[model samples]
Target: MLFKLLLLGLVIWGVYHFFIKQKPIEHKDKEADVMVECDKCGTYVSNKEAIIKDGKYYCSKKCAGVEQ
Candidate 1:
């Protein structure tokens, strides 16, 4: 009876340890993106987030002297 109880307790402990533990997460590094800087504000931004005009980069229209 004690052996059976020990086996059941071990099964429950194994299930809890495997399912209720925090898992390790992994993410790929995005190195294909280019980094850019704002001319007026001196702020850094990704190329995808910056505005391009006349071969120059800017963070926003207001900083580029294009905003009303």
Candidate 2:
């Protein structure tokens, strides 16, 4: 009886370790595709999150100026 219980416990532990306790290793890049430049500050930023106004582009509102 004790031997059967020990075997069942070991099997359960092995299954749990294989399925639940292991994490999958996923490798991917989370970068933007297009690159843009700020008009005022002349800083570069990704197009995915850059701010745009009228016909010009800037990294932020503070960088947008009258010269640009």
Candidate 3:
């Protein structure tokens, strides 16, 4: 009985490992994530998260001197 249970478990595991297809992870683009230097304080940050004003890059809106 124990041998049969082990064999059953092994068969299930093999089927799951061989038959399942994993989806590939998708990203927007590599260039969008490139590190950019902050113009105000020289801190490095990702291009997508940086604030842009007057053709300059800033780590935050505070550094860019833009206020709400």
Model 1 TM-score on a 0 to 1 scale: 0.47
RMSD of each: 9.4, 9.5, 8.5
| Clashing residue pairs for model 2 | none
After aligning candidate 2 to the native by TM-score, how far in Å is the CA of 25 from where it should be? 24
Best by TM-score: 3
lDDT of 3 by residue, 9-37 (tens): 99999888665533222333543488999
Candidate 3 has a TM-score of: 0.53
Q: Residues 1-68, candidate 2, lDDT per residue (tens digit)?
A: 99999999999999988765443421123343568888778788888767887878888867755363
The CA-based lDDT of model 2 is what?
0.73
- For all candidates in order, the CA lDDT equals 0.78, 0.73, 0.85
Better of 2 and 3 by lDDT: 3
Superior by TM-score: candidate 1 or candidate 3 = 3
Error of 2 at 39 (Å): 0.8
